[model samples]
Target: MKLIAKSMLVMGMVMSLTACKKESKLNPIPTSLISDASAYDSPDRIATLVNGLYATFKGSGFFGTQYIYYSEARSGDFISTNLNPTRGGLTYQMTVDPGISDVSAVWTQGYQIINACNVFISSMEEKGIKVLTPQIANNYLAEARFLRGLSYYYLLQLYAEPFTKNNGQGKGLPLRLTPNKGLAEYNLARSSVAEVYKQIITDLDYAEANLPANYSSAALNTTRAHVNTVISAKTNVYLSMGDYANVIKEADKIVPATAPFVAPTGVKNALQTEVTAIFKAPYTTTESVFSMPFSNTDVPGTSLANAYLPDGANATGLGSAGTGDFYLFEGGIVSDPLWKTTDKRRALVFTTIAGGNKGRQWSTKYATGSPYTDYVPVIRYAEVLLNLAEALANVNGVDSRSLALLNAVRQRADQTTTLTASSQPELISKIIHERHIEFLGEGIRNADLMRLKLSVPAKTPLGSSPVPQINPENPNYLWPIPNTESLYNKDI
Candidate 1:
């Protein structure tokens, strides 16, 4: 696949590759250029390139904010209160076009990360062993592959058809593996969805074998990819592909067979005692398998906080402040009676009364004020458990282990209410509903809807206009391939 260096420059990779640095465990900025000519000259330079991949992944255009907002808003979980087009109004209304900035920005940033990973992987394979030990070199290569695989998975969720549809015999993104440097690489065609999933699994398999079992600190364990991280990601990928057997197989690597289901070997990840604690100060809990960490110095601009939190006057004692661009939809999962008011997860939603309206709820999940420093969760242990539960129920109908896994997540938040299902379909229904409640404001809804080939649910109009339900057959069901790609990559 070919992309012009000019396109890479426009994606901000030229600057991010050389200068972007976030302070944390992955510290120590480098002053060298991250070019093919000199990027692998020293050990620190190689490490800086790795960190740069993460920086680009966590940028606002991707995971930093827009991705999460796009996923949830499009699922009808959140209604646009402000209807600000720049802030995801088009996404909420299912009106995104190829030229839309959000669509283009996400695609551009995704490819930027993928290309950086390819460059880093190639450089490491060719020259990294010269500076670093073989063991360390392979570990770094695995990390690059892990990021590359994850980027492709995320892009497919929005831009391509679901793998469950006709066994992934649908158009997918360009499977760009080699480093795209010039115009010569600009005419690559899209691959099949099954082909993309094959590549994603290949990358993740290598990562599970070569990536470290655990890191030194809790922060590194939570923020960086480890053995269990790769396993957790594979479970998600397999589940999306309707490969339930593989989901169970991959999940079994980390999740135990009994209660207190902590990963026994690498990164003792388990559900937090309290659901909200995972989102609090120093958000590096074991439950957080992988997340995009942020700090006051390096924040997710105009992303989480600004998109979710209500204004100060409206928030009152919600203990947060922001522009309050979106509110929990009255017709969303929040309205489900099964999601009890006393449920601990309900604490994340707060009620605000205004303009004679009785109870308008706003999310306090990303509660930080101005700079929105909340670490965005990429995958959590709870999700892995649910994935395993759903897969088990599919493979073995109404099984005890599957029910146990389902209740593990449910009873954690709402101890008073235990879920029960008599048959396989019933059990799966409960598990799906549990996901909607458990992952609210965390950006899992739309992906769940898509992977299962479910319709984007109809939303009730509040401050903004009503959005109709979008079935799988609708043209707007999937985000269009960005115009930038269409213009540059003729084969697309």
Candidate 2:
């Protein structure tokens, strides 16, 4: 039951020599292979391992596509047009099991990333420090820890129960900190969710302390983990735990105390005047706090565009052409009256009027055609703002700062609207609704529902495939530990 697949082991070995230099900042050329004895002998080789860690983290099975797709599809947002299990049709219907390919792939790839990080960190501790400057070595170490924490956090979200359940006393992931280099390291049991979160926070805290506050370029700022990036990620992780107080504390480290909430210290991350601008070319906006960048050469093949965009050429010319795997359900968040037609965010949705796909509406957020090189957004400044707002409302009860934070996101897309709530619950509800509208296709809905201990809302039937409402008590509410893990890891 080796968690590191033979293929991934080869990938990990090759990555040490020839990393994916998707951008000039992460350039790694094909050099002759080096054995374990000399793998961490030079600064350049160590740096290539850092870039390679990101490449693995952004694999199509992880953040590059399937993870986002699975998260959104499990929610009530999109209607599955394809019943192909290979394409996540079972996930859309909330029928994902240990045997589902996508489920198994996510589990396998996620651990691959975690193990890669462990190996990188262990190697650096053993040898990299002697070759690279202490500061450089620590920075690389922080990056690996940050990625490992993030991987565990996401895996916990889908594979385990909500952290809010009994204060994270539920079953969580195997807390594998050391490198899993061979067959003997595969029998570990799941940690309590609390223990896993403790490690996530520990890893992120180190990352925040060691990671650079900013990068030399915008691409690096968005793609690489910086101090603010670690802070932003902490805010998300805390919010998921229902730890509102800590969410506000972490968010405040980067977000301002006042309006026009640009990060004063780091990348100056603030919302774009136009929501669509963040999704357009150059995809390096301040609002894009962290994302998986893809170049024409290193694309997320058959990814977001293939799953969310329309199958043919779009009528509006926004997303151009897509595979049309799923469409906006007539009953999804788009149908809310609060989501006014005047809202600029509406442009992300394109309605088909005359074709086999007629009457169907598609999300054009990941609009890039063919090669599907859209940068997959993992966390955004806007999410930090919203997380702060939610925390504030919960902690202070209809506070002014909460109202302002909520309005900042709302008015950005729909200027004509100004939201107000008389009670704390109402304000919280409004904030949740705003999230649904703001992050419709960016993969926040399902996590939101899960964190709040809410049921997965029923989706409108597309022909005979009717997706039912999944309550929190249902076994299907949380994806099972994939057979890939269960069959191998005896502890399960």
Candidate 3:
């Protein structure tokens, strides 16, 4: 989602006044403020705010810009190159001090979007608008909360370390619930990770209660919001925190009554399913529970797809330097056969540029021509099933059902070998491994490694040929808070 820049702010003012319904009595604007709750009162007026929230998912300010890339960059997916560039390599990995550009951008951007959501939520009641109703106001408040929770989820992950058994015992990003009035109040201290997670859960619960089951195709493809996606995302947050019990509880709410992990028609395949469709464009599929919708309207074709495209491909007609600049996965060289050829993930997840040459086809999944408009799946039915399997395997042992779920995914990927049985440790490890492969470019690696307490050591094919050991204590594990937040809040 893109941040509402000053340019956008002006547009918002223009849009609200023109589209706002007659019933919306403009609230008295504060002297210093140019806009506020009054900006989103009537159905037409509040619609503009939805685009602002969607903007948070795009651009350089927040997750879409750098934070999302940070997760994949540190992982095996991409190496920095001339065409595909990443600051992390220049700063965090290679040098003594890296600039705070990427990480800080995400931090500041997320909070900015959160404040936007809060503005909408705080005004919903005062505006006497039915923003939560179907069609009337399109359930704006619920969507806002979901977006808010997702922002916090990313913030907590980036600013704070993974939660321990004590549940957020360590400091977390400062909780900012309301829209700021440009006050000079002291920023709150970092809350415990547990407290942050609690807030996230609370926000998601409210979102689920008010959101609808699914969106129509028109809504799905456009900037519009729906209810089911929020619920699916909540399932993801619970899984990340290792709250497997809640994972199962939340997933059950959306999964079809008969099918274990099927999403509704348009959103089906949100579950991990058939091998081929998994790889093709419409990059995100039916299985997606919640997705970050993208549009050419903001990012255009060259933004994301170009970065992941192979070097010198027809797809990249007017190639940008971002294309084929990074290594797709570490196992690009013959010496680093990290993945097996027979493993369907090899094809579905990656491609070789220039006819399968080493390092050439590595970043194939994200090509220049890939419609640039496919909503990136932040959470899908597949993850929910995997979460349930992991939780059940950890707590109840890898029984028949658990093994079935695990194998179901592997089978779809056409893995030659099948696991008969394994202990909890083995099962959990396998589950995570599947997640790593399944979600390679989608940005879930660091969180998986952190939560699992696994070493950040690189594998032979991907990292240093001998593999570099990534100690957890390394500052790279947790991204630095943005300078803006540090300047504003003392929590850093």
lDDT of 1: 0.83
lDDT for each residue of candidate 1 in 76-183, tens digit (9 for 90 to 100) = 888887667888889888999988887987887788788878878877778876987777777788988999999999999999999999899999999999876554
Task: Name the regions of candidate 2 deviating beyond 4 angstroms.
Answer: 1-36, 313-319, 462-464
Per-candidate TM vs. native?
0.93, 0.92, 0.80
Compared with the true structure, model 1 gives a TM-score of: 0.93
lDDT of 2 at 215: 75
Once model 2 is optimally superposed onto the true structure by TM-score, how far is the C-alpha of residue 234 displaced, in angstroms? Answer: 0.5
Q: 301-392, model 2: which lDDT tens digit per residue?
A: 45898888776654544537776778888888888998999999998888887756567788889888888887888999999999999999
Compared with the true structure, all predictions reach lDDT values of 0.83, 0.82, 0.56
Report the error of model 3 at residue 240, Å.
2.4
Residue-level lDDT for 334 in candidate 3: 19
**Per-residue C-alpha lDDT of model 3 across residues 1-492, encoded as one tens digit per residue:** 211111122111222211133312221111111155456555545556666666654545554536656666665546555422244453224222224566555665676677667666666656636433543443556778878888889777656778753466877777778765443432567777888888988988877676555454533522334566666677678877888777767656655434354654434444455655544556445654555555555443223455565545522333322345455544522123434567766663343433435434444344335444444556655676677677777768766666777667767776676756657778877777777766766667767767765656553443333335466677656666555456656554
Candidate 1, superposed: residue stretches over 4 Å from native? 1-33, 353-358
